[model samples]
Target: MSTPFSPRLIKGGLVLVDPDTAQVQRVIALQYNAESLRRELKGQESGEAGTDRAEPTRFKGVALETISFEADLDATDQLEFPDQHASAVAHGLAPQIALLESLSQPSSAQLRKVNSQASSGMLEIAPMLAPLLLLVWGAGRVIPVKLASFSVTEQAFDPALNPIHAKASFGLRVLTVDDLGFASKGGALFMSHLQNREQLAAKAQPVSLATLGVTGI
Candidate 1:
C-alpha cells in the first residue's frame, strides 16, 4: 500500500517519518532565500566562517532557494522508530524465550544469576573435559594433563637421604607466624632441620615448657 503524506522537517533538517506500512516517499526541496542569506551574513566580511556546535557547517537561512534532495535511504527498507517509541519487539516477540527482556543494566542481576548456574555446571564437568581434551589432543603417546603435572612436581623435589643417620620428622603446631618468624630468627628452622635423634637428645636444651594445669576444685 502507498500514500503521499506531508513531509515535516524535524530538528536540524532531520525529516520526520511515520510510514505505518510499506510505502515509498519522495524527497522534495530543502532550499532557502537569497536576500535572507544576504541579511544573515550582512555585517560579516566576505570570507567569514561560523563557529557553533558543528564546525565547517552551512547555515540554512530564511531562504529555501538553495535546497536540494539527498537520497539518504533507499525506499526498499522499512521505516525505523526510535528505541523509546518501539520496545515491543525486544524479546524476539516470543513468550517462552530465555532472555525475556531488553539487555540493559536492570537485567544484569538476572543475567549474573543465570551465568553463575551455568559456571557451576561447567566446573562439575571439568574433570571429564580435561581427560577428553587430553585424549583428543594427545593421540595416545602423551599422558593426561592433570596426572602428568602431578608426576612432574613430585620428580622436581626428590630429596637426598643419608644411610648412617636415623632421620626424625614431626609436626609442631604453633600460634602465629610472628611467633614462628621470631622463633626462626632464633634458629628454630636450623633445629627443625636437624634429623639425627641422638644429636637432638644430646643438644636438647631444657627450658620449662609452659603448661597451665587446670583442676576443677
Candidate 2:
C-alpha cells in the first residue's frame, strides 16, 4: 500500500486475562510507544495475511473515557495504563471525570428550561400592559383631575346674585398610562411566529401544481 495506515491511538489499555478468576481487565496507557507498536502490528498483519484470512487489527478492549472540564486535559498527558482492570475500583472509587459528565447534561437541560419559562412569562404578560397603559393615558387626558379644593367667596362673582347660591360638583379620578410598544411587542412577536409557522405548514404539504423545474426540492 502506497499510503500509510494512520496510527492507532489508545487511551485505554490492553486487555489482560487473569488466570485465577478468569476475568479480563483493561491495562490503560502504560506508555505511548505509538511508532514501535505500529511497526509491530503492521508486521503481524502482513505475516498473518499469507494464510488467506483477513488479519485482525490489534487492541480490541473496553474503552476508557475521560472528561475535559478543565483546559489542561489533552493528548499530551500520560497516565499509567493499569495492570489490573475495573475489578478493583468497581467497588469503591468513583471517577470524577464520569461524575462531571453526568452533571453537564442535566445543567444544559436546566438552562434551556429556564430560558423557555422566561420567554413564556414575557409573552403571557406583555399584551395586558400596552392596552392598560393606553387606557390610563386616555383616561388621564379625558378626565379632569382636581383632588384639592378651593372655595371663593360670593363677593368675588356677585354681579347679579343673592350670595351666588349655585352649587357645583367636581369629581377626581386616577388612571394608568398605557405604553403600547412595551406591552404589545411580546405578543406581536409570538403571533408573528405562529403565523409564520402556519405559512410554512401551508407551503410544505405537497400539491399538484405547475412544474417550476424544481421537482423534489
The models' CA-based lDDT, in order, is 0.23, 0.28
- Expressed as tens digits, the lDDT of each residue in 1-217 for candidate 1 is 3346755432111111112221222221212211211111122122344644442345432111111121121111111333542322232112111121121122555667667777778544221111011111112211111111100011111022111111111111111222234232212322332223346578887654353454432
User: lDDT tens string, model 2, 24-88?
Assistant: 43232322222221101112232243475543665332122111111111211111222353321
The pairs that clash in candidate 2 are 13-28, 28-81, 29-81, 133-177, 133-178, 134-178, 136-176
Model 2 poorest ten-residue lDDT run: 128-137
Residue 115, candidate 1: alpha-carbon lDDT: 75
State in Å the error of residue 180, model 1.
Answer: 64
Question: What TM-score fits each model?
Answer: 0.11, 0.14
Worst 10-residue lDDT window for candidate 1 reads 149-158
Error of 1 at 76 (Å): 40
Candidate 1: where is the Cα deviation over 4 Å? 1-7, 11-106, 123-217
lDDT of 1: 0.23
